[model samples]
Target: MSAWAADRQRSRVRPGDPGWPSDVSWQQLNQQVGGALIKVESPIAACVEAPTSAACAQLFKSLRNPYFIGDDVALTQHLGWVDAWTSKPSAYAVAARNASDVAAAVHFARRNNLRLVVKGGGHSYQGTSNAADSLLVWTRRMNEIRLHDGFVAAGCGGHVAPQRAVSVGAGAVWAQVYDAVTTQRGAYVQGGGCTTVGVAGLVQSGGFGSFSKAFGTAAANLLEAEVVTADGQVRVANACTNPELFWGLKGGGGGSLGVITRLTLRVHELPEKFGAVDMSIKAASPEAFRRLIGLFIDFYGKRLMNPHWGEQVRLQTNNIMRVSMLCQGLDRGAAQHAWQPFLEAVSAAPGDFRFESSPVIVSMTARDYWVPTTLKRALGLVKVDDRPGAPISNMYWPGDQLTVGEFVHGFDSAWLPAALLRDDQREALSDALFASSRQWWISLYFNKGLAGGSAEAIDAAKDTATSPAVLDAFALAIIGAEEQPAYPGIAGHEPDLARGRRAAQGIARAVAELRKVAPNGGAYVAESNYFEPDWQRAYWGTNYPRLQAAKTQFDPEGLFFVHNGVGSEDWSADGFSRKA
Candidate 1:
């Protein structure tokens, strides 16, 4: 057999394999990284050893706090998904504090023929950050932030004009960046809606926030990045330098291209006010719920399909509709006026609808929107980290609390085309939505779709590696179910396998209903189903071939691999061996 064929047959060295590194080798690596190497253990190790101990109790309590989860070397934001994956700690981790440290770890892992994993905020729903018997490059300590008034890429001095931007370390979360950019400086940077999600991961995954309709995706706003490629070479990628690598980094999925140490993103002018609308409407029967869905779809297409509105609306099995949408550049009165016509239509049919409560329309100063004090003291819509001595800014939305360390039963998403909102097609679209909700709750996330965005926002998203489908999509319909933190080996906290399987089935059926209308719809890689069959096409569309070429150029040896990420089809399911 040829050398290439022989190499393809070999698997990465495991813990007990003869090719595994010796104790001296590990010690040498530790010294090279300034003694930042860590001997990892399961986050629940203490709980397993002594379930009744005070330390174990405290650890379990800390699991519910996203800040605590992100700070640990072994834990991921999600514990795992049922049957799909379980968070497993690597045998060792190099707690990377800088690009040089990350490069050193990469060199060691490649030379040792070891499985490698990279983690930042550890928020991958597909469990890309955790693997057993591997060596981890953990970038949780590289948090730093800097603002630039007129930034230009290194090699684009004259060709590219200077622009306002922010440089953020991989470990910095959205909350930190928003506090610095929006609250402190009164500027805006597009990022994830979840406060604790890592900046690097979200940007790499084509991030969406409450204001994405106005600012575009996080990846599209990327100005430059500092990356450590598989060959341990630290390179700067931008529009003018290493352009191919730069294109791949935007929406190509994290942990596949390289380890991103820092990213620079373009900043936009902050609007005067940020606002939200919350209300619940219950339909007396299934017939009324169908009409309600049809009415909202028509209203959304006519009035709300613009740069101002974003966020989600929910269609539930209990014949109820919930609205938790947001807006920017519009104050209380304008937001209210935009929705008055729809509210009046519902009120006219009292025999079919009942209001759970009066619609709450409110607006606040744009600068104070992300302030912890505003969410806690003024709005009472957030849950603060109660641990003594924690930073006062450590707060998350009350609605987001359920996802911290959650054991997901199932999750799936699909982009609904803007064409579906036409008067001729509204009935088919509404029928699919109402049918899907019978099996599971359907959430229509309008911000994730860029169809009716500003021309600047749409053009920016077109330049990134994200699926082309998003450009014409009015909303991303997400169907999912989950249970609370349930890691294996914890007696009472173990996953309910039987129940999870049933939920998974319902999630599948719900997605099937949507497929009947949007047969070839593309999915968002960041929130797609773990068992997606045609992932390459589903995630990247025509962009997959270009992404593969970039992957081959940068990582010909296939050193970096993540589940369903770019070029991942070349490796085995567990990413330990190349497919023969």
Candidate 2:
């Protein structure tokens, strides 16, 4: 027999084996790495004897550790934050300090015939960052940000002149970037609202932000990236070098093509002033709520071409709705004048809809409005807030205006029926279905590139790998909320997996109904369903084939795999080839 075959047979742990790895083997393997290595523990036991034990405390502090194995509670909490359904048990974890470290981890896992998972920020809603019985390379500890004359260096430090860009570490959070630039240079990048979200994960999945109306998505702002391919070679992918890899990295979703180590992104000057407004409306009944939602959708359809206006509307089962907005370069007076028409329409509505400031728009600067939300906690970063609960939602890329009539049909056909289920029925239903019966939200992202005429607008087709559907989108929303039973469910800690599945189905059905209103429209990958029926078409649109080619070129071995990512069709959730 071959030497390798003999070694494999000797190490094999047959099913139901009493002891896997011969006890001492795990410790010996742990000692092989330079960074911290931790043996996974049970959170329940750890919490019971020592509620305030070091292990429990380490869960929050070890977020930036170079390496550590998470206990059951740590793993559960981490998974719970992003996705409850995608949670699974993991026995080992390694925190990589640099590209070489990553290469070693990859080698170790491959030689051991172990599944490997790459994690950044732990914010993958689809739970692609985790797997059962997998070796997880958590990159959160590889955080570094440096600034040079014109350019800023992230984890993999490099200096480039003309200084128009910032190189961000794969593990760096968006809040860090925002605070660094705005505090030092009065600048900012198009990034997510939440500060703790990792820049690499969001950018790779096509990120949008408050400034996207004027600047474009975080992916569009990307100029270059440094990634470690399956062969363990650290390659720099940029517009001029490894351009296809560059294209794929821009919006192909994280942990797919490779482990993104660093990113160089073009930065934009923040407006001298940032302004915002909030408006609230109450509907007496479901019919009124439908009308108000339709009117808001119509407003976005007409105002889609406006580059400086951004609005977010939330709808609830209690016949209540709210609107929040951000306007750049415009003072309070100018912003009010610009939004007068929309304000007038709200007042004319049959529902009790009005601005927070009656008959006028009250705009506040970023300092006055946004900063106070966190009570001067962390500079530049929003206070760490919980993510929306067991959200079963999808993006609605509206191509045209939606009337109150159409809005009524949408709610009646897609939403209201789900919400009408009894509390017991909702509980009995899968988490996916129960969560789908929640609240509805509409987020308006103005695409300047699609708006035409603006020199700043990105050409969705040519600029990056982001879905072109966003280019034509007038009002995009993830409009589902949980009500019958609170999401993450009443259990609080242990999540309902069955409910998660049902919620997935509900989201799919909801998407199908919304698609009828805009058949040609597509969904956003980051805010989309985990099991989207035609995920490739929904996330990448016409860019799928190109992204697929890039995936094959850079990762032919399929080393970096994630569900719903490009070329993911070849692999099942367990890292097994579906073709087999």
Best by lDDT: 1
lDDT of 1 at 151: 99
- Please give the lDDT score at residue 169 for candidate 2: 83
Instruction: Give a tens-digit lDDT track for model 1, residues 373-476.
Output: 75365667876767789876676787887889899999999999999998789999999999999999999999999989999999999999999999999999
Worst 10 residues of 2 by lDDT: 400-409
The residue ranges of model 2 lying beyond 4 angstroms of the native Cα positions read 1-33, 42-84, 151-161, 285-287, 348-455, 481-492, 496-509
C-alpha positional error of residue 483 in candidate 1 after TM-score superposition, expressed in Å: 0.6
Clash statistics: count for each candidate: 0, 17
Q: What is the C-alpha RMSD of each candidate to the true structure, in Å?
A: 1.6, 9.9
TM-score of 1: 0.98
Error of 2 at 349 (Å): 5.4
All models: lDDT?
0.92, 0.57
